[model samples]
Target: MSKFGFLKVAAAIPHVRIADCDYNARQITGLIRKGADRGARIILFPELSVTAYTCGDLIQQPTLLNAAEQALGYILSETSQLPVVGIVGMPITYGNALYNCAVVFAEGRIRGVVPKTYIPNYAEFYEARCFMSGEEIGFATIRMCGQETDFGRNILFNLDGVKFGVEICEDMWVPAAPSVNQAVDGAQVLFNLSASPEVIGKHNYLLSLVKSQSARTQSAYVYCSAGYGESSTDLVFAGNGIIVEGGQILQRSERFSLEEQLVVADIDTERLITSRRRTTTFAPHRPNERIIVEISLPKNPADTTLDRWIDPQPFVPGSPEEMEECGNEIVNIQTMGLAQRLEHTNCKKVVLGVSGGLDSTLALMIAVRTFDRLGLNRKGIIAVTMPGFGTSNRTYRNALALMRCLGVTSREISIRKACEQHFADIGLDPTTQSSAYENAQARERTQILMDLANLEGGLVLGTGDLSELALGWATYNGDQMSMYGLNASLPKTLIRVLMRWMAERCKDDAIRQILIDVVETPISPELLPTEEGKEFGQQTEKIIGPYELHDFFLYHFIHNGYSPAKILFVAQKAFNDRYDRGTILRWMRLFFQRFFSQQFKRSTMPDGPKVGIISLSPRGDWRMPSDANADTWMREIDRLIEEEK
Candidate 1:
C-alpha cells in the first residue's frame, strides 16, 4: 500500500494530560485538522483518550466522567469543519451501564459509536468494577447536531466505495477479535483504538500481531495507541501509531516519546477487491449477531491527491538487519532447491554458461555452493564460456578468471564459428539475418551446454532470471529451457544488487573483482554485433526501461493485482524526483503489454524455487491463462497517460 493503493488512512497519536479533558480535546482536534489538511479521509485516535489512559482511579469519579462526556460532544462539533471521519474513545452510558466505546465523527456530526465488547477484568484493569459488557443492541439512532447518528459496529461507513468498521482497545489482542466479526459484516478498514502499556521488548511483538492480522483479514488496519501522557504510576505508554495494509506495517512511530505521532498509509481498495475476488475464502458475513448501520458518507472528489508515503525500495523490507536476513533466506532457498534437484538426478556435476553477468554469476555461485554441500569436487562443476557476436573482451576475460578463481573446470567456445556453420546448414546469409540470426547463436550455445552436460553426466543450469522470464526476453528452448533454474525468481534489479553485495562480502579476490565489474557493466542481451566503436552492445534498458523501475512495477502489478492506472499513479509518486511521469507511463505501458503477451512463456517455465511472496513460477506461485488479452490493460494505460498530460 505504501507504493500503490487507493485507501488513505492515518493513525494520529496526540499528546494528552492525565484527567484533563479540555487539554486532550484541543490536542486531538489539532491532529484531526492536520490529517484533514494532508488529505487523509479517515483518522483514528487512542482508546479512552478523552481523559487519558493513566487516569485509572480517576475514571471512577463522577467529575472526570462528566468532563469526558462534555469533551466528546465538543470534539464531534469542532471536527465537522474537516472532510474526514475520526474515531475517539470514551465511556458511554447505555441501559444503566457504562461501557467503553469509540465514537466515530464526520463532517461536524456524530456518525457512529462502537462499544468495546471484551473488557479486561484481569490484571490491573478494573474495568469490571466500572463498566459492563456490550449488551445485544440494534442499530439505534441517536441525536447528534439535530440529526440521527448510527450507533454500533454493525455500522459500515461507505465513503465513495470504501466500507470501514471500528474496534476498541483490547479488541484486537483477544482470541476472536471484534474486527473479525466486523470484517465478516463487510468492513474494509478496521480502526482499532488502543491504550496498551509499553513493556520491555513488547513493541516488536505488537508490530507482528498488527501486521499478521491485517494480512489474515485482507483489510486496512489503523492502530492508534496512547502515547506519553498516560499514567506512569504503574505503567508506561509509547505513543504507538501504525498504519498497515495487507501484511506489512507501512509506517510506525517512534517508541516511548512524549510527543504526538502521526503515520499515514494508503490502502488500495481496488487491489483489495481483486484479492478478495481471487481469494475464494473472502465472502459476506453470516455471523451469529450483527448490527446494520448504513451511515452517510463523504463525496468522492474527482482529483484526490493521495498524500501518502511511498517506499523507495518496494521488494526489500525496511531496516538494514531485516534486509540482510531476507537476502540470506532467499539465497538459501535457491541453493537448497538446486541441491535437492541434483540429488534426485544423482548428478555429480552441474554445467552452466558463465558470462560474468549477474544471472550467470549467481547461477555459478549456487552451483559451486551446491557441489560443496554434497562434498563433490569443485572441478566436477563444468563452467562453459561462450563468446558470441557481442561478447566484449572485458566480459570474456572476466568469465575465465571467475572459473579459475573458484577452482572449477572451465571451457571457452567461440559461438561465431559455431553459428557460421549453423547459418550455412540452414541456407541463411551471415549478413542478412533476422530473429533467426539472433536465435541461432543462442541455440548453438544451449546445444553446447546440454551436450557438455551429457558428456559429463551433469545438469544444465539455467541462468535466465525472473525479469527475463516475465517479459519473454529469453531465447525460447535455448536459454529459457533448463533442467534446473537457479535464478528464475531473482529480478534484474535485485540480481545486480545481490551480486554487488556478494562481491563486497566474498573473500575470493578474483571472483569479487569480476562481480564488481559485471555489476558496473551495461545490461545487454548480446544479440547485436559489436562491429564498430560501441562500448556495450544491445543494452536491455534501452528497450525495457530501467530494471529498478520495472522491478518496482512488477512488485505492484502481480503482487497486488494493481491496475495500470494505479500503477502509473504510484510510479510517479515513488519516482517523482528520479523519473518524470511521461517516462514512467511509457514503461508502465510496456510492462502491461509485455506481461500480458508473455504469459505463454511463464506458463512453461522451468522448475525454480519460490523465494519471495511474489513470484512467476508456474509450478508454484503463478498460474496464468496464456490467452489473456492485453486490450483492456493497454487501453487503461493509454487513457491514464493521456489524462495526465
Candidate 2:
C-alpha cells in the first residue's frame, strides 16, 4: 500500500452543551470515531468545543477549567485506538491567565496545543475580559491531566508528511492571519475551529473569505464552526462546516442543523505542494519561534475514490441558463476578436473555406456577426464551400442553406478535378484512396482560399477548433494553415453547444432551421470519398476518438498538468456510465500520443484569441519545442495497460 499524496480530512460540527464538559467530550469523541471510520486522517472540531464557546465567564472559574481538562483526557483516551489526528477546542491556563486554544492529539497522547492568536474584543465578542491572546507567548508546557504538553500558536503538526497548522474563530477574519505565516512556513493544510454567529448575510462573506484565503495561501483549509447546541441568548450559531482545497470548496454542511454535522473530503496535498513549488512569487521565510511535531498516521493506500464532482464538460457550463449565457459570451468574444482584426487591418473582405462541418459553420457564423458588428457589407464575408470526395448531402445542403439564409455571398469549387490532376502530376495513383489522396484535397482547398483572399484583398479565416488542433487531426499546410483562426481556443464539445444555442436564439426562421440541422450533423473532415450513393463516410470521431474524451484529456493535460495515470483514473469515474475502461484507455493513449507528436503543428499555429483556460496559442499560453520526446509518457501508459491486464 503506497501512502503519499492525498490526505483525507474532516470538518466536524459537534452538538455542544454550555459548561457541560463531559457531554461535549462525548460528542466530540463520537465525531472523531466517525471520521476515522470514514478514513479521515485529520478531523477538526469547532472553537472551545470542550466547554462550548458560549460558556462565557464560566471559563474563568477553576472548576469549569478543571472539568474541561479532564474531558480532554477522556477524549484522548477514547480516541486512542483510532488511527486519526483530532483537533478540538478548549480553554487552557498557562500562568495567571486563561487562553482559548485548540488541542491537537492522536493515539491517546496530546501532541500539542495551539492557542488562539487574535482574541476578538469588539462587536459581540469580549474575549479580552476572560481570555488572553497567544501573541505574547512563544512556546510553553502546561500540565493537562498530569501530562505536560507542548503549547503555542506557532506549532505545526507534521503527520505522515502532511503539515497542518491551527487558527481559531477570529484568526481568519483579520487582515494578516496567523494562517498566512503558518502556510509560508510550510503548512499544507490550515485548520480553523470557528464559533462565528450567523447574521443576515455573513455566510457569503465568510465563504468568500475562505476561498480567497485558500487561493492566496495556496493551501487546503478545513473550517468547522459551532453548531445549534450553544447558548442563543444574544446570537444563533448556524454550524457551517466547510472543507476547501486550493480555493475550491469540496464539502459544506447545512446551516442551523440540530444534529452533529461531519463533512469529509479528500484534499489533494500533492497538488498544493506542486503549486507552491512552481509559483516563483511564494517566498517562505523560516520563523524561529515555530515548532514542528513529527507524528505518524496509519500507512494506508492512497485513496483515488473521489466524493466530489468530476464534471464531464469542464469548459462548458452545467446549467441551462449558464450554458446559454456562456454561448452568448463565447460568440461575443469570437465576434469581437475578429472585429478587432478586421478594423485594424482595414481589409477589403474576409475569406473562409466552409466545409459544412461544425468548425467551418461556426467560423462562417462568426464572420457574419463580425461583419455586422463592424457595419461592413455582408458580401465582403465570402463563404466558399469546397466539395471534395467525402462531402455528404446533409452537411452540403446545410452549409449552402446557412450561407444563403444569412445573406452572405456564397460560391462552390469542387476539388475532385484539381486533386486528380495533382495526383497525375505527382505520379501517385488517383484510383487509390490513401493519405496522399486525402491530403491533396485539403492542400488544394487551402491554396484556393489563400489565392482568393489575396485577389479579393481579404484575410483567410481559419476554421479548425481546439480539439482538432490538440489532437493534430489537421493536415499540415492544408486545413491546418490559416491567416487568423477564430475557433482555435474552443473545444469540440463546446462548439456543439454554441451551434445549438445559435439555432434556438436566431430570430430568422430559415437560419435557425439550417443551424439546427447543422448541430445534428455528424462531425467529419470530408477527406475520403463516399460510397456510390450514400453519405460521406469519413467521420472524425470514428477515425480519432470521441471529442468529449479528447477535450477532457486536453483540459486535464494542459490546464492541470495531470499525469497519465491520474487522468485515466478520474476519466473512469467521470465516464463510467458512458464508456468502458478499455475504450477510455485506448482513446487516452491515442490522445497523449497525438498531443506530444503534434507539438510541431501547434508550435507554428496561427494567432487566435484565447477565450478560456485551455488554449494552445503557441506565443501566448503554450510554448513547446517541436522535438520534445514522449518516451516517459508512453512508458507510463504501457504500465497502466499492464496493470489493467
Candidate 3:
C-alpha cells in the first residue's frame, strides 16, 4: 500500500438544544461514529456543544453543569470503540471560576483540555459575564467525570503524524490569535470550536478570517459553529463550517441547514510541512506553556483518495472575465519590471530577436511599452527577425508587419548563410537535419542580436519562457543566454493569452491583425528545413507534449511538490475525455526526466522579475544542483505505469 501524506479531517455541526445536555451528547456521539467510519482521524464539534451556546443564564446553574459533565462522560464511553480523535466544547469549573473549554479525547479517554482565550462581551454576546478567560488560569489539573484531565490554556495533542491545537469562538476573532502561538509551537493543524451567530455579511468576513489565519500561520484550520437547534431568541445560528489549508478553502458547509452537517476534507500535511520548511521567515519554536499529549492512531490504511480541488491550470483562472483581468495584470507586471530595469541601467536602446512566436512577440510588446513608459522614441526599440531554413512566410511576414506597424526600427537578418558556414567549419553536413543543425541557427541568431545590441548601445532581451526552461527546450548558451529576459517568468500557456489580450487592446488595425496572426501561428524554432513549401513542419508541441499538460505538471510538481501518483490521478480527472491515462503518464515521465536534466540551463539564467509562484529563476524561487539524480522519482513513475497497465 502507498503511504498517503493526507489526513482526512472533519468539522461537524450537530443539532443542539439549549441546556439539553443528553440530547446534544447523543448528537455528538453519532457524528463521531459517522466521521470515524468515513475515515476521519480528527473530528471537531461546535463551541459549547454539550449545552448549546444560547444557554444564557442557565450556564450558571449547578444542576445544568453537572448534567453537561455526565453527558460528556456518556459521549466518551460511546466513542471508545472508534479511532477518531475528537474535540468537544463545554464549560468546566476549576477552582472558584468557570472557563469555556474544548476537551480533546481519543479512545474513550480525555487527552487534555484547552480553555477559551478571549471571551466576547460585545453586542449579542455576554461570554465575559459567565466565563473566565483561559489566560487567567494558565495551567491546571482538573478532575472531572471520573478522570483527571490536564486542564489549562497550554495544551496540544500530537497523535501519530498529525499534531494539532485547539481554540474557541472569539479567540479567532481577536488579534494575535492563539493559533499563531500554536503554529509556533509546531502545530500543523488548528481547530477552532466556534458558536458565533450569523449576522448580515458575517459569513464572508469569517471565511476570510479563516483563510488569512491559515495563510499567516502556514497551517490547516478547521472551524465549526453551533447549528439550527441552538436558541435563536436573540441571534440566529446558521452553523457555518469551513476547512482551509495553506490559505485555500477546501470545504464549506451550507448555512441554515436543519439536519446534522459534516464538512470533510483531506488536508495534505506533507504540503504544509514543505511550505514551512521552504520559508525561512517562519518563527522557530518558543517556550511552550502547553502540555503535549501523544496518542497512537489505529492501524487502518490512510485514505489516498483526495477530496480537495486540484486546479488543472493552477496559474490561469477559468472564468473569462478573471482571465482577461489576470492577463492585463500580468502584462502590466512584465512591462513595469522591464521599465524599471531599463531605467536602472540607463540604456539608450533595446534589442531583441522577434520570431513572431508567442514568447518573442510578448517580449517585443513589453519592450515597446517600457520605452513608451520612459518617454523614449519608438525607434529606440530595435526588433530583429532572423529567418532560417524552416522559416515560414506567414511568421516572417507577421514579424516584419508587426515591427513596421508598431513604429519600431525593423531589421531582417537571415541566419541560413551563417548557420551553413558554422556547420561546415565544425565538420558537419548542413544537408542533414539534426540538433547541431538546429542549434547552429539559434546560436547564429543570438550572436547577431548580441552584436546589434552592442553596436546600438542596448541590451539583448531573452524570449525563452518558464515552460521552455522547465523542459530544457531552449538551446544552452544559444537562446538561453540574454542580458535581461522579460518572458522568463511567464509560462507558455499564459503567454498565448497575453498575446491575444495585447491584440484586443491594440488601437491600430494593422498591428492588431499582425498580433492576431502571431497568436494563431504554430510555435516552432524554424531551424530545420520545411517539406517542399514554406509551411511549418517542425511544430514544438508535437515533439514536446501539449503545453497544457506540461504546464500542469510543472505547477503541481514544483509549486505544490506533489508525487507522480497524485499528479497522474488528478490529471486523469482534470483532462478526462481529452487525454487518456497512458498519454499523460508517458508525457509525465518525459517531463520528470527532462526537468532533472535541464537544471543546467536554468542554473545560469539571466536576471528576470518573478511574476508567479513557480519561477525557475535560481536566484529567487528555485535552486537545485544540476547533477541531482531522478532515480527515486522514476521508481514512483514506474509503479504508476504498472498500476495503469
Candidate 4:
C-alpha cells in the first residue's frame, strides 16, 4: 500500500488461443508487463488462462497439463524481474487429483497457489468431471514448475501490508465461498479468476454480484473473466473486468472487446479498514487456518495520481435517476415526519417563517404537503414572512408570491419596529449593525412565530438546515430554537437539488416558477440592512465558505472519519477545477474551526428527523461535547499552509 493507503491493482483479460499454451502464456506475460507499467502492484488473470478455459477435455491429458505448467514457468521467468505480483489460473495435479487453481508469483518466485473451492457440475459447466474440490484441502505444500510453495484453498498473500485472497470462477457464485473465510481472516482485498460464459442479462447480474460482494465484505474485489479468442461452440466469453471497493465500482472494462483488456484502479485499503473498525456487527467468524505469504514491492511514487472518483457533492446524488429517487424519498420522509408530529400533538396548524431562502422554502413545502396529508386546511398552515433589515425586495416578493401561489395563509410582519424597541431597551445604538442587531431580528422573528403558534395551537416549524447548524450560523434562542426543525438533517447542497426536483414536478406553473426563483435567490438570513436595489445584502457562502466544500468536509470527517489532512487531500482533487489549493485550504480551516466552536448550538438544537447518513442530532446519530477543542485540527491545517509557502 502507498503511504496514503492506496494499493494499485489490475484485472487483465488476455486474448487467448484455446489449448495453445505458448500463445496464451505470451499474451498473459504481455498484459502483466502493461499492468506493471501502469503502476499496478498486483495483476490478476482469468481462470485457466495458461491453456484457456475452453480447453474442454484437453485438461485430462498429461501432455496438455505439462504444457500448461511449462507455460506458467515461462510467464514467471519473463516477468520475474518486474516488481509486481501476477496471479494466473492453470490446472495443477497433486496426489492423483487435478485442481483448477490460481498461482501467485512475484519476483520470479512462487508465493502460493489457491485452488478452486467449488467445482461446478451444472448445465453449462462440467468442471467437476476433471478437477476435485479443494474445500477440505487446508494448508498444504505443493511442487510445480521446479518451485515449492504453499498450496491450499485458504492462502492469503501479503504485499506491502496489503493482504489479498483469490477464488475461482464457481467459488464466487456459491454462498459459502472461501472468500468469506479469507476476509474473516483479515484479507483486505479479494480476487476472482473467472471464466463464466456470457448470456443475456448475465453481465448485469454479475456486476451486481461484484458490487454487493465487495460491499458485504467491505473489501476491494478485483474480478477478471475470460474474454475474446475463447472457444465459442456453445457460450461466448466477453472479457469482463471489474474493480470495486466498498460496493462502489472504481473501473470496469469494455465487454466484447477483441483486444486484450486490463482494468487498473487504486484501492483504498485504509478506508476499508476504517469502515470495518466502525461497524460493530462485522463479527469475526471461524477463522481460516490460513497460511500467509509475504512479498515486498517497491513503494509507489508520492506523486502518483489517485485512480478513483471523488464526488464533489457528497450529499447530493450522483446520477439523474438517483437524484429523482432520493429527492422523492427525502420529501416523503420530511412530510411523513411532520405529519406524524402534527398528528401526535393533535395540532391542525403549523407556523413557519419563510424568507424565500432554500431552507425556509423547503420547510414551507414540507408543511404544505404535511397539511395536505393530514387533511388539514391550508390556511391553518401559517407562513409568516417577517421582513427584517436585510430582507431584499427579490426575496420578499418571491416569499409572498410562493405563499400566494401555494394558497397558504401568508402574513407580512415587519420586525423593524420590534428590533428597534429591543435595541433601545438593551441600550444599543440602532445605527450600529453588530451581531446583537442581527440576532435581535432573529429573536424577534422567533418570538412572533412562537407566540402565534401558542395562540393558534400549532407547532413552530424550523428552517435551519444542517449546514447552518454545522457552521453555527443560526442565532441561539432564535432561529436555532424551534419546536420541530424539518431541515435539521438536510444539508444546504441537497436543499438546492430537492428544490429543483420539486420545481420540475410541480403541477402549477406559477408555483413552479416561484420555487425556481426561490432556489435561484442568494442564501441569507436577511438580518442586516440590504443595499439599495440589491437582492441580498450578505451572502452566506461569503461569510462562511461554500456549502459544497463544507458538506464534502462534513461527510468525510463525520461519516468516513477521515482526518483533516486526508480530507484536504481528497478535497483538492474533488474541487480542483473550481477551487485552488489555497482557496480550499482557507475554507477547510474555517470548517474545522466553525465545526468545533459551534458545537454548543448543535448540542441544544431542536428535534428533527434524521434524513441522511450524516446527522448532528444530539439525541441520535451524532453526540459531541460542547467544549471540544479544535487546536489539533487547526495545527494540521496550519502545517499544510506552511508547506504550501
Best by lDDT: 4
Could you tell me which residue pairs clash in candidate 3?
154-290
How are the candidates ranked when ordered by lDDT, highest leading?
4, 3, 2, 1
Compared with the true structure, model 4 gives a TM-score of 0.97
Per-candidate TM equals 0.93, 0.94, 0.93, 0.97
Candidate 3 segments whose C-alpha is farther than 4 A from its true place: 299-304, 318-325, 501-517, 532-535, 563-566, 569-577, 642-645
Q: What local distance difference test score does each model get?
A: 0.80, 0.87, 0.88, 0.89
Weakest ten-residue segment in model 4 by summed lDDT: 297-306
lDDT of 1 at 63: 92
For candidate 4, the per-residue lDDT at 507 reads: 95
Q: List, residue by residue over 40-75, the lDDT tens digit for candidate 4.
A: 889999999998998889988999999998998899
Residue-by-residue lDDT tens digits, candidate 1, 425-529? 989887875889998888889999999999989999999988887778888888988888888888887777778777888997877888899898888878778
Regions of candidate 1 where Cα sits further than 4 Å from its true position: 1-5, 135-155, 282-289, 299-304
| Structure candidate 1, residue pairs in collision | 6-268, 7-267, 54-231, 80-107, 80-108, 227-239
lDDT of 4: 0.89
Instruction: Tell me the deviation in Å of residue 16 in model 2.
Output: 1.1
Better of 1 and 4 by TM-score: 4
